[model samples]
Target chain A: MTAQPDQNTAKARTFISVDAMGGDQGPAAVVAGCLISAKANDEIAFILHGPEATLSPLVSKHPILAERTTIRDAVGIVTMEDKPSQVVRTGKDTSMWSAIESVRSGEASVAVSCGNTGALMALSMIRLRKLPGVNRPAIAVLYPSSNAQGFNVMLDVGADIRADADDLLRYALMGASYARNGLNVDTPRIGLLNVGTEEHKGRTELKEAYDLIRKQEQKAGFEFVGFVEGGDISGSKADVIVTDGFTGNIAIKTGEGTASLIGRRLKEAFKYSLLSQLASLLAYTSLMRLQKKIDPRRVNGGVFLGLNGTVVKSHGSADATGVSAAIKLAAQLVENGFNDKLAARVAAILPTEESPQE
Target chain B: MTAQPDQNTAKARTFISVDAMGGDQGPAAVVAGCLISAKANDEIAFILHGPEATLSPLVSKHPILAERTTIRDAVGIVTMEDKPSQVVRTGKDTSMWSAIESVRSGEASVAVSCGNTGALMALSMIRLRKLPGVNRPAIAVLYPSSNAQGFNVMLDVGADIRADADDLLRYALMGASYARNGLNVDTPRIGLLNVGTEEHKGRTELKEAYDLIRKQEQKAGFEFVGFVEGGDISGSKADVIVTDGFTGNIAIKTGEGTASLIGRRLKEAFKYSLLSQLASLLAYTSLMRLQKKIDPRRVNGGVFLGLNGTVVKSHGSADATGVSAAIKLAAQLVENGFNDKLAARVAAILPTEESPQE
Candidate 1:
């Protein structure tokens, strides 16, 4: 039967290792996120890696997934409470470890975790190693930018702290690749976060990086549209904005806070008494649509790039829906041959360049 | 005749030096903000510092405050477009510098600027110098916390970038003083920002700082309540949150972004169609009240404590209302004898056991 199928000349489906014990709500939320993800597409298969004692019974509850999902027993589970170095050291037998190993050994195309982030990243670096021609990798998530699609992708949310000029250029390249293939865009534009749009503004490092990004754009065939301030992080002014984890984290939090404060303020304003509640009923649909658009849960996951394998990390406080969306994304990224394509493209370009080699 | 009704004995009226050309809108907006602030109180005198060419006519427009507001001729205005260090180096006749000088020479108790911050700060540090026992001072802004009064305070928002363990302790001390004297709290609690709340969760520097803050709290008289995460920046968990300028800036931006995003989304959600516009009309009065409660303009200014002379920096984008509120705050800080009280408090206690000189 294998020979007969091989003769048909079609590609084999990609496999993903999912750490079911990784999220805030543990296996239940992860399983729910996975189920939602699995429901969206029928082509993807998952290897659930975790302690059999706790997870075997949990998976048994869903009869439909019995065939589509299989288990890889792991002795440990990385806890959110664990210290960074402590988790990295202790997670060898954990689900996160097994999942990363699967991707490394060619058994799985991608791995997904919503676990102790510092641990996941630490172990991931050791397990898969960085892609050739890349230094430190970055984690990027979708933020609601007031653009046509209602979101823009921002990188280096937490992965790399002290990124230099080369690292940023690489981020721009990877983000461009992701936007093109993953988001299905034809041309992706990159912007540098700054106090002002003038080329002369920003710190020395950013200025140097700006020049490098511009030079690379001139030759590397991506659009570099110049600098963007905090005000434009919300919209069509730019596509992929690059900044230090320090600023990126600040910007993200600021955006999140502003969204919450404004929402609460507006609610309090329109919600004086019983009549205002009635008024809300009339405007409820539009509100729901916008809420659906900006809800963090909907975009609750990020992709940690530059690792050897494709690993999707969900937000620490993600619920079932968020976890599910991450699962679907992990499945899609692996299915798209993310690593193979990115590696091929990088290898194709970097040999002639002066960058240090693997 | 020289005593002029014994001004010192007659309730010690406050004097404020206002940066007439600091903000984005310049003299007109500053003048407008002053009008509202002037309306709120009657015992304050404003020493407006800026180019006479631009400000003289603006002051003339408000003939009501010919006596209360006086225009001092300065050659230039500090432009946000200029580099902070460059402006400080080259612009002596600038409005920001003249305003700062006015404060230092005791012509004004407090200097309020909406000018280029780098220049403003440089001028303050160069002129007024530091308070005794303070290594470096920080700009502590009272942000909306989950307190009963709907406010909490954070420090070093954008004052200094490279804050060490001792600097943070100093910030905490000053913030505590501001809380006790300005906000009127009996015992204010302090928190240090880290990735996690656990004792062992921060970086080496943060851990080092954490230990010092704790040691100081126990050994000294300060109330040290443990570590806080980014989420705690909003909630009523701590009265004073201290972090480096980098983290503090991030926290502040995150808070601002969240508030603005919520407001934007609400407007879009509620005003989608003509009928929904009618809904907004029905709840207009309550919305107005909520706006008054949460608007940034109402809490326009932030005090730059720990200087020999009091200084406040309003947001560059601050409108007429924000400027007015800033002026009122400067007056209050001066009238309350901020410098004398802080100095006395610092002197009363032992060096390490001393009250924070906010």
Candidate 2:
């Protein structure tokens, strides 16, 4: 059935292409997330990609999404086990490919997926292509931080296993731009992630990138905070933290794991005795507030930067809340015209082929 | 005055060489830690390395240490800003150098330092030297984990920045041995840290190291779990986590930062309202239990592996509790004869120059 043209549609709604089949919770969670977004936002819509037989019924269950959702059928599925190289060659009929195709076709402003990260990245690169002057595309995520903004932008979480000096410079510019538009920070400060804050520490490549990122501070409209250790990732030292994919991927995951472990232990502590049980009941509201402050589900999406179009990779096991968070992030980026601004920001300071040297 | 030869010392006490002047809290904390350890364990002794004028007074204040501690008069102190190269060339009189020298001269079974990590590692390498068949030395730290043992062993935290296939295999062997002898684990399980558990994912060096590590599983007396993600670092998936120094450093620091942030937020949450404050009082014991479970100070020491002598690098800002934890770890390793066992473990599985192939 065709989606009805609602009154909000006439105002140029931002369309988010979502893959409905790949998440561990399946299509129902994706549809529920869309309903949550649709109920909260009138200027957003979704083009859901999956088997019509499955997604149509799920969308029908949510009356709010009936006017804002469109289903596209695809037979193939990209499981967590699917190899990215194999998916690139033979994933034409997959829902993930179809979801990205909507963004490539200019029908959607951004694409959201809970599929295999490697497969999703491979598909996005092949479909959307990298923006000008971006040697390598990076995945940027918002981390829970003690900054005034309550978050910090860190890049190259797992886009590729490696990044060089030029790639890091591009990440700094693009990440700073993201902080400006997406996070709305004026003159975002950038910090290169290293083992120590010392000038002569870390590997040779990090030392080389240190000078490169610092040189572009004035021209890029950002402050260079020199080097930062992993402790600074959640501190108020910088608005944007840049690092190679290998280190970034491990850092974020370690943060996630540590937070989860503390959360679990807190629950157990509250159940230890009768007094603790009553204390937990009395402190439930405050504990919930503390939980919301560090909730990973609240910051669920990892935005793939340096691509022609915006792509938000939701956690593979994300529940309805996580999916909704990802959708909200995608909507915000689209509303702010983040991709176009990021492209302009990179092009402005990028060295030309004639004078590659800074 | 000379230290009295106590009954415990007559029974061959394990002497720990301690650098007292370099910590942020100065020698007072070091002396306090020795007092704590001396009161707790009768078979432990210390060779306090620093300017005698500063340490003598500090040691005098702790009666328990009067019979168990000997002050070594080293004139120079290695500040955190001192370069490793500079310290190695002219650090003969530095407390850190003197600490390592005590271990080298066969007076102390292990050395514990709260000095510059680079300087400590450099001096340890110079004085203790690498064991036969060991290429690059690694720093092994105990991470709070969900394992039955309450901790996991992770290596190469920041000793060196690079690890090739052979180096990774060595880390696997060394980390596994540390888990067994230090943590009292039988047939410790080893996991190579990567961005993903998938065999096809991560760098080529990792894939090669995976096979090389797997080849030594039976011979090394450990179970190789193939690959593990960052989340598994705190999970019960493996007892020993192996990684390059750069990633390991970032992971551990990220864990520390996140834990610290959660702790600060929890305090604020408890102070949000009067009822919450009262509830926090009731939950004080339980919350403290949870806090003690994840306290970084409880696991404050990073052990230097692959060297002829064992060295524990305590946190620079460690207080009495932290320093005591480091001393306890050093005492345990010395009691277990960890260095000799680790060297033997490496010599058994290490590829010989005559037959370098697996």
Candidate 3:
């Protein structure tokens, strides 16, 4: 979809705040990604934060990017090695901090970063702060699945290592909002991640959260599908899978590792013999299609939800395609007004002071 | 490896008590698997438990199985739908109970069942009882990994939802012993499963478990590798990954689901066009090799460790191949005297009354 016409007259254009440094591929890839997003959507604009000298040459190479982007100079960079606590305390001048500042200052609709995950999360939480009644903010990611849209939303993927029942309930509401806005599902089916689907299984907090989520189905505008096992994460049964950050973090990584292992072995198999190499050539298109289906780079953004503003985190190792995907996700969330809708959803089902605790 | 030939000469053979019913594929598959194991290893014998009429026909069809197996009549069956508590309370006459009874009575070296996991675990714990100083028993399963043996041990797949620091320590000791016996790892590297390898990350218990497992490195005959993430589960970095049953169960299933999804997509890719189909034919051998590498059926059994006697739980949906794999694992455990070694290992590192609580 090209930039919407009305020449930016009917509606205000969305400006995405981007941290162009600290990624594995550096500012060049991030700048190229901004150009790609800008070329795709005319209504898109960028507030690029980085070492201005380095990013300026890259942005100037793409004339459209130079015209549509506003570069902000930042003296510091948050390396992947920097601890979250350390970054939060002393990373004030970092590009990551400046990127979040644009959102915090209401100069940008959303922020996209390919920095250290912990630092990005800590910085985002500290700057924008959690929404009212949000005890824990979660990172919601879309996973390739056999669903109608070929994706499922899973949340709490490493934001907080611990989550109580109330925290999990908020994840359900936030994840549902993400699925609805990000994935375009009208009424997402939300499932609590568990070892088993039976009501008697999993931790006590999960059962408590299960009951709480069930109570929110009508007002929350989603379907509560009960407990979903790990298999359901990729299966078509659930549109949104919610869990404590600890389990979600491990499960997502495990999925990634498993996919990579198989892909590596498949490559080895196709290169084993002369005839196999010939076969690989013949099956090139099909192989590319399969690769596209499973490539982690294609779906590269993890939305840090429950915060006052939206932040999309691309993988640090992401190339141009990955960065562009994160930007596209941020733009979509902005167009859908996801953060405000998520706040409303969370506020509706949030636990009251009089609610009993397990 | 063939069975030891001193069958009736130097020592009594290892007899694995088998539950001949309650599997998804019925008695035929279980009996066929027993026959395969007995034929491969003359030293392997079976105390097959099921209804006399049904199991006799299946067992008799395989002459070798009939010869090496001693039929034990069990009037009832513990189904997949049966609750663990219900089975333990009223399943005395079932094959699952009878199978575990053989181990408790010293009539069998170990128990192997292709039945309900929860029911099998419940029966095994009730009959064999927990080992001394063990707070909770864990189910250890070997996952396909890039390690030397192409497998790494992970526990508790679904024995208990909760694991305190002490329970995790026991899992480490037991898992290490299982790796030594099952995978023939000389000095298994025990890793505490967490969101990251960093010491300061994850929940309180994981950090506590990390400290506990570290202190047992020397006495437990294992190497402490500190914290490991989900990617390490499939990586060669750690030999035995320890976690609570809740996380382990979910991770294992997620891995299984992921592998299956990739496998299915690969098949689709190879059949997308006539050229790809011809390529599939030319690369058939390599594809088969790749398939075998990631096949869940090849790695079948989940060993319920930390009990007075050993019990191996096969996948309920296992075919003859899966059942044979489980039986082979049980035979290997018996041959290595794994249960005794595990008990001794736990008794050595188990926390005492004076240990400080977290």
Interface C-alpha RMSD after superposing true interface residues, each candidate, one decimal? 3.1, 0.6, 0.8
Model 2: residues >4 Å from true position, as ranges?
Answer: A1-8, A351-353, A356-358, B4-9, B351-353, B356-358
lDDT of 1 by residue, A1-358 (tens): 0112112224455576888876778787777776676667666667888877777777677665555677888978888877667766766888888988888887778888888877888888888899998887888777777666666778877775667877887777777676665666667788887656778755678788897687677445579988876666676777777776656755676466546655676687667788777777776777777788788888777888877888888887777788777877777677677767766655555753576333
Fraction of the real A/B interface contacts present in each candidate? 0.35, 0.83, 0.74
- Which regions of candidate 3 are displaced past 4 Å? A1-12, A350-358, B1-11, B350-358
Using DockQ as the measure, name the better of candidate 2 and candidate 3. Answer: 2
**Per-residue lDDT over A1-358 for candidate 2, one digit per residue giving the tens place of the 0 to 100 score:** 3453233445778889999989999988988888888888998888999999888888887677877788889989999999998999999999999999999998889999999999999999999999989889999999989999999999989998899988998999999988997789999999999998989888888899998888778878999999998999999999999999989999999998888888889999999999999999989999999988888888899999999999999999998889999999999999999999999988887554237555
In candidate 3, what are the lDDT values of residues B265-315, reduced to their tens digit? 889999899999998999999898887877777788999998999999999
On the 0 to 100 scale, the lDDT of residue B15 in model 3 is: 88
Best by TM-score: 2
Q: Which run of 10 residues does model 1 chain A get worst, by summed lDDT?
A: A1-10
Q: Which candidate number has the best DockQ?
A: 2
CAPRI category for model 1: acceptable
True contacts kept of 2: 0.83
Residue lDDT tens for model 2, B8-98 = 4447788888999799988899888888999999988889899998888888876778777888899899999999999999999989999
